[model samples]
Target: MKKKIKFMLLVYTLFLLSACSLRKDIHSYQKIETECDEIVQYLSEDDTEGLKSMFCNMTRSSSEFDKQIQVAMDYFEGKVIEHDPFTLKNDGSSVENGKITRLYSSPHLTGIVTDVGKTYEIKFYSYIINTDDEDKVGISKLTIKTDNGNECIIGEYIR
Candidate 1:
């Protein structure tokens, strides 16, 4: 009987740890989704500064992130950006039973044209957030794809 109680206690302890951090995770997910929606809005209005802020929040303080945001700013200003009807998210920014402490953005899809009028699909390939509470951030590696199946990194930015 003592052995059974000890085993039950062990399981209970694990469950408590996982549940303690869960409510926070759920709130963070809501924020990410809300942010992505706001980004689409900024894209629609061609808001350059707003775009920069939105993208910057996802990246570390790197020059690479700065450059990509410029590209995004330029693209929105001149080239046409047609956002898809629905945003795409892999694994849905969620963890099982709540114990999730990670923050992530859903992969975003947008159609863009260069200044010279070349067209490409811009897809966010990276959205990394530090698991720790530190202020560090990471840029998501992004790829631009032409209809012909060729792809290249347009920019690595904190998105």
Candidate 2:
């Protein structure tokens, strides 16, 4: 009877720990999703200052960053008509509780930056928050990978 009770207690503890972890993961994903949405909105509006705030300090000073933003704004402004919500892809390496946290680690969000004019692929990068608060997430990077396979890192806020 004593052994059975100990085993049950251990099982309960494991279950609680698993539940807490699951909640934390969900919260992190939600935070990233929200940040991505804001980024898209800023880009669509051609709000250069707003978009610049999301970039890391180092990136903001780069000449390439300014050029990239200008190109993106020219393509996206008054052209984007719809925003598709971001989704996670399973790389098949890490899986837990029928879900994979790896997918959430660096989720890529794509959207149509134009509808009638030339279309551009807008890629948003989601970074996991390293702070003590697990519920926080932020956009660490942005890119516009052209058809020539050339990619530009427009924004980076990873710290």
Candidate 3:
């Protein structure tokens, strides 16, 4: 009887652990989508301050900053970006490995002429919040398009 109780306790602990992990992962995934949408307002006005307001207080090192910026930079260059958020169609089993793997694809921007004598290619236009940081959520990396819809990875270095 003691052995059976121990086994049940172990199983209960494992179930709790997995449930917590899944909830965290799904919450993180939803955050990415929210960040994408919130960044849209900043992108429209080219407002870096607006972008900063959207972050939920996160921090990062310089190198990490560059990596996230690249994600945006690629989009600004007229590349379509698609994200694979753990949804698979061809698997025989329905359950995943309990670990969420992200797949990023495509570019989300197109080269377009916004007005006379001005064409724009998006540099990194989306603002992503660093969910793990407490003070860096408002931070955003960026680049911009030149008159001919060409991208310049200048970032908020200027604006």
Per-candidate TM-score against the hidden true structure: 0.49, 0.66, 0.40
Task: Name model 1 segments beyond 4 Å from true.
Answer: 57-106, 109-122, 125-154, 157-159
Q: Higher-TM-score candidate among 2 and 3? A: 2
Residue 157, candidate 1: C-alpha displacement in angstroms: 5.1
Minimum summed lDDT over a 10-residue window in model 1 is located at: 130-139
Q: Give the alpha-carbon lDDT of every model.
A: 0.53, 0.59, 0.41
Judge candidate 2 against the unseen true structure and give its global Cα lDDT, from 0 to 1. Answer: 0.59
Kindly report which residue pairs in candidate 1 clash with one another: 59-158, 126-140
1 versus 2: better lDDT goes to: 2
Error of 3 at 138 (Å): 3.1
Name the top lDDT candidate.
2
Runs off by more than 4 Å, candidate 3:
45-49, 55-134, 143-159
Candidate 3's TM-score: 0.40
lDDT of 1 by residue, 112-153 (tens): 544545565555533334455333332255454565676655
Q: For model 2, name the residue pairs that clash.
A: 56-156
RMSD of 1: 6.9
Weakest 10 consecutive residues of candidate 3 by summed lDDT: 85-94
